[model samples]
Target: MHSQDKLIMIYGANGYTGRLIVDHALEKGLKPIVAGRNKEQVKQIAEEKGLPARVFDLDSVEQVANNLNDIAVVIHCAGPFSATAKPMMEACIKSKTHYTDITGEIVVFELGQSYDAQAKEAGVVICPGVGFDVIPTDCLASQLKDKLPDATHLKLGFDSGSSMSPGTAKTSVEGLAQGGKIRENGKIIQVPLAFKTKTIDFGNGEKNAMTIPWGDVSTAYYSTGIPNIEVYIPISPKGAKKIKRLNAFKWLLGTKLVQNFLKKQAGKSRGPNEQQREKLKTYVWGEVRNDKGAWVTGHFETANGYELTYLGAVAVAEHLLANEIEGGAFTPSKLVDNKLVERLPGTGEIHFKPE
Candidate 1:
């Protein structure tokens, strides 16, 4: 199925990352329907881009399914996906439309996995974290697993040189409210923010990194069957201390009042400009260790976060549309492979070694 043969809709097409995905899809010669809950905003964006529009919220599964009529796939970009993934996923399964999203939330990834049976039953593929959230890390983890098939523990880290979009900032706020997480012995468990810190060489010299509730904490487990996993991001010592301090106020941060206020502030900030997106880069590092203390390490480089999201999300949707992949939930690397990510625009060669 080519672009003209199948209709794809981009929900949340008015948001910053959503807009980037729309542009990428258009550049690939696809006429995707732009959609979101705000009728006026969605319509305005669609009109400006000269694309069709559909306005619907995830409040009701029936309503959402109705809006998805005749759409072959949906690139669900609206996030803080902890709140949106379940409903949108249910609607997608109900409507028998393939579902993909740019979510990096562990809860959302698990939520998608929970619907694997339903998605398979309905013959609809459900894939999330098709963006900067987990693509690079997921691919890294998969590669490490390939290098060390008996790996028992997996660690992934990333350093991105781009600014966050409003949606990503809001998602960061949501993540902060939830504290930190990691997968151990095949189960997810909560911990304090910045619970662990270390130095990692993500293609560059060593940098300080701290553990966060990155999507790979959940996705890498599924992608590589690694029973233990931890994901980290670059952070300064001061930043780590600040996050550690917030652990005492986790209750306040999780409160609706505080969350709403913080999200509002995050929403007001504009993301990276075109020049910034072009100039910045992202690096991913992964290591897998076995009971015998054997290990393998890998590193990858790619475009900036939002730029990778646009390229990765559109590419995943196009692949789903053109192929008859199995009907089930998947991580980005699990759905395709590391090669798919390696082939994206601005992706660099991957390096791996055993030690």
Candidate 2:
């Protein structure tokens, strides 16, 4: 793809993750068009970064579709995607533009899958969960499938870096509010958030982990035909107890008052700033068990989750720009190559062992 033809649009250009993605895209020599509902913010970012900007309300599907001309792909960073992904996807399908997002919400991911036939017909790809939340897990599962060809159960655990961003916190809060699901007997089964806990030893030390709803919970089921899949994140014992306690009040999550309250809390929540991110370190370990009782595991770590997410997004964007992947709606676990995953930064540390 010529540099001029690589017109990438960042939908939530003013936000935290969006800004990182935009900066990475620019560094890669791709001139990105910063776009968002907030014209002033978008314009400011574009002007400061020396890029172009566009304003569009996500509520208007027609307007989004109309604006897709000449764009190679749209890297959507706006979230709470359960409310926004569908419309944006419809617009992309109408415009025959490739669509990718960092969303890990199972509901939104499943909704993206529902567009497979339409996207295939349009010769466009709609990929969701192309970031840290699922990419590492997805890629590890794919690798394990190669080592344990008959694997039937998959478990993933990760030690996150200290520097959590507002976007990450918001996603976590939303997932907590909605609860989580895992594959069982070849079907999606809803479960209470943080219902199960495990101790994962990644060689550094054993960290307490909780069952979290990760995109791979859905993606791995279809990609590897694994009947059971679970993703876990290491948390402090105190944090684990707090999450368990929060489960008791899950009912409140459905109430508007609670939701609004969370929104307010999320607005005030601050994550580590730029300097802290530079010092952060993240690690992930994964295990896949076969029906015959054989299992294999792998480990990976990085400077930070957000940085890894930016690298993953850039990898996905490069693939989209080159039209290297088959055109259809899919997840990273299904679409991205395991070898390529290893080559990506922070992924080289991944080590696999069979038992």
Best by lDDT: 1
TM-score of each: 0.97, 0.94
Residue 154, model 1: Cα distance from true site in angstroms: 0.6
Off by over 4 Å in 2: 1-4
Q: Any runs in candidate 1 off by more than 4 Å, and if so which?
A: 1-5
Predicted candidate 1 versus true structure: per-residue lDDT over 1-355, tens digit per residue:
1234588999999999899999989999999999998899899999999999988888998999888867889999888788888888998888888999999888888999999998889888999989888888888888889889999999999888777788888989988878999998999999999999998998877999999998888899888999999988889889899989999999999999999999999989889999999988888898999999999898878899888899999999878987887799988887888677788888999888853
